[model samples]
Structures are given as C-alpha cells and as structure tokens.
Target: GDDAKAAQRVVRQWLAKKGITAPHLVMENGSGLSRAERVSAREMAGMLQAAWRSPYSAEFISSMPIAGTDGTMRKRLKTTAMRGEAHIKTGTLNTVRAIAGYSRDINGNTWAVVAILNDKAPFGASSVLDQVLLDLYRQPKLPETASVL
Candidate 1:
C-alpha cells in the first residue's frame, strides 16, 4: 500500500511537470502493467514524441525493441520492409494490447506511432499495430519537383 501510494505520488508529480493532462490517465503503482492503469493512444504518442525530442532521446530509443531484431519484436515484421525501421515498446494484458514507438519512413522522416486495443478478444490487435508500423515504413517517397521562382 505504501509503495503504491509513493508510486502514485511520484507519477503524479512527473505528469504535472511534463504537463500531461490526459483526463483518463491512471498510474496504478506506476508499474504500467496494472489493469487499473489507463492512457489514451494520443497520450501515449505524445509521450513518445516528447521522448524523441528530449536530450536523452538516443538512450531512450536505444532501450526499445527494434522491429525484427531484438526484444519482444525480435520475430515481428521479420519479412517485411518495416523490419529495423521501428523502435517500439509493447504492452499486453488479458484484455489490452498496445504499442508505442517511432518509425522511420522510406523518405527518411521519423514518426511517432501508438496503438492501443481494449477488447474482450484482443488476439488480433498485434497484427493491426504491426500493420500501422509497416504502413509508416512503406510510405511512398515524396516526388522531387523543381523550385518555384
């Protein structure tokens, strides 16, 4: 109980400092794996974007699972063009599945992506999330055009 209280306090302070005002955010014990913990996909994406802009961005991104390379993503997107283009973090629960991370597109632009599924049957959610990343990686390259006067 005490640990949970302490965690809540610390998390609340961090959220306030970060100005994250997600109305539905709940950090139960700050473990991020609790059924009571809640955050919207928009909020998760915002956080990832913030991490990308932070001074420690390199270290933060390095800690994530690279698609088709390591961590939970070692076997994911292995045969697809998305492989090695995304650095993602995945979450799983009986009724919840989520992914949040950055993906570098074919045009060299980086994008933050997040997907969360809360359903009675979340079995196929990962496929949808993987598709999101794949689509990002497969974006068509921008056409080169002459500069206007």
Candidate 2:
C-alpha cells in the first residue's frame, strides 16, 4: 500500500526535525507486510525513548499492549512479576520477530525496550523478551543518592 510510502516520508521528516540522520532507516510497508522493511533495534529504541518524553507520551503508551492484560501481550509474561509491568508492541513474521515498548525496573525506572530478530525459528523469541522484563523487575535496587534539586 502507498501508506507505507507516506509513513516513511513522515518518519524521514520527523528524523530531520530531530536532527537525526539515520542512513539505514528503511520502511517499505507500514504494516510490516513486506520483508523489505528494515530497521535497527537502536533506532526503534531511540523512537520509543523519544515517545516517552513527548507531549503525547500517555497516548502512545496507552496504545501499547499491556502485559498479561490485553492485546498481544495479554497471554505472554503472565504469572510473572512482569505482568502488567510492560506495555509492549510485538511484531512477528516467518523470519522476523520484534518487540518494543517500555517497562519499569525494580527501582521504578522506566526502560525503553526493543529487540529485533531475523531468525528461522521465532517461536521462543517472546520468552526471551519477557525474561528481560522479569530480570529488570528482579534486579537489585541501588541506593538512592541524595538529589541536589
């Protein structure tokens, strides 16, 4: 569909506005239907992090799949500490797997998470991503230093 092309142009414009020159950015289909679509984990992470700080952050976060509650993440990460702690959007294809969103660490730190894998077997990829969320939740909390605000 031409929506992909339009979306790609808009993304490029946004990147320019942010003064980010991502030479490797490639978007062939907005729905990720085409294998030609390409993106790096780093770029996706940057996008998610920016969304976290944007004025529409709440809207963006609310659109994601809440872990163990609803959407694609509903059935995943259930019965774990990561349940309801992660708002992730997952993507899968015959040869591609991707998950990107935000999660809170044990110390209440919001982390932007993104993982992209091009593998023949993507069945177990979600578990790997969920484990990361669980690990973040179980990580030891560092002593809080005095804030000089």
Candidate 3:
C-alpha cells in the first residue's frame, strides 16, 4: 500500500509538472476503477498527442489495442474502414464509457481522438464513440482553397 501511494505521488507530481491541473485529472489510486479518479477528454487527447510526439512514440503506440484486431477492441469497429487504422485504449464503468488514442485517416493523416460519456443511462454509447472514430477515418478531403493550418 505504501509503495502504491508513493507511486501515485510521483505520478501526480509528474502530471503537475506537465501543467495538468486538478480539474483535468484526479487520481484516487493506480486502478482506474476508482469512482474518484477523473480525467477530462481534452486532457486525455492532449496526453495522446504528447505521446505521439515523444521519443518513445513507437513503443507507446504499439502498446495500445488496435481496433478490431486485439485486446479490448478486438470486436469493435470490425466492419468499418477504421478497423485496423486506430490504436486506442478504452475504459468502461456502469455509467461511464471512454476512448482515447490516435487514428489514421484515409488521407494518411493521423488524428488524436477522445470521447467520454458519463450518463445515467449510457447504453449504446460505445457505438456512438465508434462512429466518432469512423468519421475521422473517413473524413473527406478539404478543398484546395481551404487551409487546414
């Protein structure tokens, strides 16, 4: 218990150094199952983006579950165009569902995506989240006159 607490303290310090405020994150314990543990979707997306640009990006990306291929995502997005184009981590609770990670679009651009639903009746929220990824994967090309910058 002492060791776990110490690890949590270290993690909190590191998060603080990264400028993640208390409103964005609250770690009750190492286990994500804690009701008090919280992180906003924006913060999760930011973290994913940071990881994507990190020196250890390859290792970090490889550790995530590939959509419709492995881990918790094995059966998800199986028939979609995004099946194998995403590396994501998923979380679930009785009233909460979330997904956060990088997804590659048909145009070869990578995008960070995060969706979290905290509802009293969050039934069918997974499909909604899946659609969000699919939409990103199938995004239409912007016109030449339109600047993405």
For every candidate in turn, the CA RMSD to the true structure comes to: 5.6, 4.5, 4.0
lDDT of 2 by residue, 43-90 (tens): 777777667778999999999999999999989988877788889998
Q: Which sections of candidate 1 miss by over 4 Å?
A: 140-149
lDDT of 1 by residue, 12-93 (tens): 6776677766777887766787777888987777677667768999999999999999999999999998889889999998
Clashes of 1: 0
Residue pairs clashing, model 2: none
The best candidate by TM-score is 1
lDDT of 2: 0.78
Query: Model 3, 11: alpha-carbon shift in Å?
Result: 2.1
Residue 32 accuracy (lDDT) in model 3: 84
Poorly placed runs, candidate 2 (over 4 Å): 1-7, 140-149
Question: Against the correct fold, how does model 2 do in TM-score?
Answer: 0.84
Q: TM-score per candidate, in order?
A: 0.85, 0.84, 0.83
How far off is residue 127 in model 1, in Å?
1.2
Best by lDDT: 3
The superposed Cα distance between candidate 2 and the true structure at residue 136, in angstroms, equals 2.5
Q: How many residue pairs clash in each candidate at the backbone level?
A: 0, 0, 0
User: Where does model 3 exceed 4 Å of error?
Assistant: 1-8, 16-22, 140-149
Ranking by lDDT: 3, 1, 2
